[model samples]
Target: MAHHPITHGRAGLNRRTILATGLLGTMAGFTHRPAAASETPPFRYEVTRSDTEWKARLTPAEYRILREGGTELPASSPLWQEDRDGTYCCRGCDLLIYSAAWKVSVPKGWAFFRHSERDAVLTGIDGPVPSYGMSPDDDTTMIEAHCRRCGSHLGHVLLVEGSVLHCINGTSLRFTPA
Candidate 1:
């Protein structure tokens, strides 16, 4: 007896069906995959030899975040709602981060679209991970902010959808009136 193949209107595992099923499985696998353990934590400031001297120069909020592990109140930062022609400098070191002309308002609290070329505020990944764990549904760009002078925690660099990362709410941040 010969084995007859089932003829059901283009049956016997079509290429399109196989590819579709494989793609679906891959998407499902990725969708339910576990997230990584690396997560960005809240902004915490560290001290240096000159930190003591800088602390004397900063305000209470600046000291709390740049020197000690602290977070500034949301919408409480004057820079968040600032609409002036000035620069945003490090509260701990007075290094310019944002230019008086580059500041702009965005949704993620106080948002700045540009940074000064000589500004010291920048992102570093070698720092410790934050307390929160990575979320599978969230983006995976870890940003670390440090003082330009003492390398203290001014706050965090939030990665926006575009190539823009807003550095906001760090305790070591201060705005200078131009």
Candidate 2:
């Protein structure tokens, strides 16, 4: 057989060329992963300013948590040790959620209960996730809350075992202290 190379410099492609192309695509994906994965843009919770005006309605701790996105220290919430008769309402908008008869202690300072009263509170939806504990766990529920009129992020809710749910402080709600 005779070789015909008069018209071209190269005869055929090689394995290295194909491997290099694939490697370049993989590199591109790796470079962009972090930028996409860690970016959570900020969102507005409510239209009105509920913090300053409502200071008098909450204790110092509730004001810090509900107005500043602060978390109450474990075993420090008044609700953890409270034994009273009243409903818990948002200090910001006074939207009621829990009745005094429903509070339960689970070693976490905040209180847990079965559910919220209809028309007394609103829940925002959380979508599906891929990893362990990425979404709310079987004992936890996640929801964005707001006054029906104000759209505030009152706090997050986590459903617990035996149908109990915890409404943690989220820098936008307060109890009436009664």
State the lDDT of candidate 1 residue by residue for 35-90, as single tens digits: 32222354444435565686677777667777664667777666677777877776
Query: Weakest 10 consecutive residues, lDDT, candidate 1?
Result: 1-10
TM-score of each: 0.54, 0.49
| Candidate 1: clashing pairs of residues | 41-130, 91-172, 147-152, 154-170
Tens-digit lDDT track for model 2 on 50-156?
45665777667656665554566666556666666777766666677666677766666666655566765566654333245665552343464445545544555
- Full-model lDDT for every candidate: 0.59, 0.55
Q: Candidate 1: lDDT over CA atoms?
A: 0.59
